[model samples]
Target: MKKLTALALGTVMAVSMTAGVSAATVESKDDLKNATIGVQLGTTGDIEASEYEKDGATVKRYSKGSEAIQALLAGQIDCVIIDSQPAQKFVENADGLKILDEPFVEEEYAICLKKGNDELLDKINGALEELKEDGTVDDIMNNYIGDNIGETPYESPEDVDRSNGTLIMATNAEFEPYEYREGDAIVGIDADIAQAICDKLGYELEIDDMEFDAILAAVQSGKADFGAAGMTVTEDRLESVDFTDTYANASQVIIVKAD
Candidate 1:
């Protein structure tokens, strides 16, 4: 009877431990197989995480990365997949989450315009190349991210010409340190970069905020002149619109409960 009781106690402890951690802990990419994942709708993270669905994983989509993080805090998801910079920002603000050291995917951010719009595309590409060459792109990027952040903000030259009329940029404003709302204004790395591009090309810049998923469609339909919300170049996206030369590099990362 004593031995049987000891065996039963051990079984209970084992089950309790498994239920507490093994069921929800995610330490690596492979662990996503059949796991519950959270991601912002239409993001590359969502696209990649959806692949796990074939392995029985269930993916919950949210409008913003912050929403997915909130769902994580509520125990509604086992993990969140998002871009590295915004993931870092979210983890800094949230007490119980951590971005895994392993990166999920590498990507390059670019500006998108409607297909067959080579005239605008070529002009934008020219502006982008000049920006990269003169370090304006680096200044804009450093101002929002990295050690020089907030110390190297980009400003439009006082003598910039705007005879080319206004160019509307479509973006999602919920992504912080990239493109997010600051009071009534939208600002971030991507915002400054777009402004610089417009300044170089003699156009007045106008920003239009919308759902991340809808930015591409807006550009494709000519509702917006371009899309620049930290958007990446993917083969799937190429079918709908043409992308400019890459302006930035980013990675997808996994966020899990720290404890």
Candidate 2:
């Protein structure tokens, strides 16, 4: 009887051990401290993921967010850190990938101009306010990102005077629904918002696409009037350029393998 009882207890211990191993989960951002994280180079995710690097985590930098997602799919990385909007795009198009229920960080998106350019800042902010007040900004965003939460259509305003000439917008066209290639032209929320702002201000709109990291340099060097690539304002960025009033709220999220 003693021998049979001891064998039953051993079997129970073995099953419990197996269950514990199978139940291991990564449920929160804190669980990823030692994970291999992927992020787009020079993005807010890239900036914030560095904090994990200091704590012995490894990071892989991709030139585009899609590249990071591809790496995640190929088992090259444990998870991806990216903006919530773009994360939706990637998750919808891929299998076995999902965004965590908890957001890693929340941020606001805005346009950036050269530091001390209060004149342009004031002009843009004024146009943005009018766009917000009359529901134009929300319309532009919903046009590309969808209006699942609510709905309101938009109407084009009358053309303003073009005496101020052209306003060049620098953007990275990899962020879907915010700034991505539609046919041969860049078309998305930022593109539409910049166009609407130019229309309101009476300036012809010109979009310039380049590497995401090159946008700030383009604005600062006078190559572009401003940047509107779903960019989030950060203290490090503030040192280089001033931001207009936030036009949209965004979040940084973690993409991990689905349980």
RMSD of each: 11.0, 12.9
Which regions of candidate 1 fall more than 4 Å away from where they truly are?
Answer: 1-23
RMSD in Å for model 2: 12.9
**Residues 209-234 of candidate 2: C-alpha lDDT, one tens digit per residue:** 99899999999999999999989999
Report the lDDT of model 2 for residue 38.
88
Candidate 1 residue 107 C-alpha distance from true site, Å: 0.6
**Model 2 misplacement above 4 A:** 1-26, 148-158
Q: Rate the local accuracy (lDDT) of all candidates.
A: 0.85, 0.81
Point to the candidate with the largest lDDT.
1
Kindly list the per-residue Cα lDDT of model 1 for residues 109-178, writing each as its tens digit.
9999999999999999999999999999998888888887778888889999899899999999878778
TM-score to native of every candidate shown: 0.91, 0.86
